[model samples]
Target: MRVPILRQGPYLIASIQAAVTDEDLLHLGQEVVERVGQYRSRGVILDVTVLDVMDSFAARTLRDLARAVRLRGAETVIVGIQPEVAFSMVRLGLSLEGVGTALDLEDGLALLDQHVRRRGKGGR
Candidate 1:
């Protein structure tokens, strides 16, 4: 599907749309991780505002991807989650506990910048 991953300074940004299948997400995970390492990104912000229905598989994939990215020494942030989608995810019992979220892309990028700076200062 070639989800465009833009390199913005030390961060990677992606805007996901349309219906994402399991295979597509898997490839995306791999590609993202590779890019993270290749670019040595400090953080990533993925905009999921256009996703109307986030199924369990997709939610799980996102959570797992975030964790994987962290293991690669990069922070992950999810932005633009609609209220109904958030409620639906909760209702479906898929608690995105460890996943970082923001009200919008700007907030996500700002939050990620802060996280990266804090981590850099903390050296952890």
Candidate 2:
């Protein structure tokens, strides 16, 4: 899997390219957390638009990724979820309430910027 690292102000955007399997999701989560720490970023916006489908493993990995980001003193946001996948997640009872989500990459970036500014002001 090739992960593209994009530096946009205080946020480090990671564009994941390739399917994230269950076995590799953990490592990917760790990588994202490490990258945030390395960059000292306020947040990470994951662009998973390339993924056509999201399975239970992927959803669980996302949850774990959010936790990892928090542990590293950064926030995680998921972007570009397809309608079908979103419906499936909702039907499956997967709650993404605690994690950040946006309809598109641009929206995600904006949200991250807002979050970073808020955190900076609050010293969080």
Candidate 3:
């Protein structure tokens, strides 16, 4: 089941709690986009802790979700990618460049909080 980890002020945190199939990945992307719209949030922290594998579809979906968040005047940060998965992404030349990433959930929230503070300082 998809679980939202936190909701603080204008920031929301969500978890992708399973090995996502291609179809599920697409649905997840859509759901994130929709949630961003529904919440009118400023940022999102996506906890991918339960995801052990990252395929092309998952990567693409995440990229799409980031784009969608931006279009909704929000930002997306991905977290909890295992070291091995990070290595694989680097080896595959996957570009999560514009998308923020954190080693763990706490770091992800801290990053998001920082971004929010920065944006509040007229960085938007």
Candidate 4:
């Protein structure tokens, strides 16, 4: 149940797969946030393309995770949401508020850089 979090300068990337329990997801979120502080990361990119179905609880967990990261002074971007999943989540009123998202991992990384630049932090 160890989630792999990779550091890249001032950023972290977490690619989550399926078959995860709610507890595991919570643990993963905690680890990601902790690593942000440990690494002093300015940005986080969570690749959720591998997730096919996300329950409301899981969605909430993600939202909480993003907020937690932001509270730690880092921007978080959720990337790789499938078209259908995106539609379903929106339809279910699970749209992640106050959270950033991108089409894919590459786009998410670019978005993070943009956020940093917009905040007057030069690109790394």
The lDDT values for all models are 0.88, 0.81, 0.79, 0.89
Q: Give candidate 1's error at residue 92 in angstroms.
A: 0.5
| Range of the 10 consecutive residues with the lowest summed lDDT in candidate 3 | 1-10
Best by lDDT: 4
- TM-score for all models, in order of appearance: 0.95, 0.87, 0.86, 0.93
For candidate 2, give the lDDT of residue 121. 94
Worst 10 residues of 2 by lDDT: 16-25
- CA error at residue 46 for candidate 1, angstroms: 1.2
Regarding lDDT, does 1 or 3 come out ahead?
Answer: 1
Where is the poorest 10-residue window by lDDT in model 4? 115-124
Model 2, C-alpha of 11: deviation from truth (Å): 2.0
lDDT tens readout by residue for model 3, 1-124? 3444467678878788775457766776777778777877888888887777787767877888898788888888999998888889888877776899998878987898888788889867
User: Cα lDDT of model 3 overall?
Assistant: 0.79
What's the TM for model 1?
Answer: 0.95
Query: If the candidates were sorted by their lDDT against the true structure, best first, what order would they fall in?
Result: 4, 1, 2, 3
Off by over 4 Å in 3: 1-8
Clashing residue pairs found in predicted model 2: none
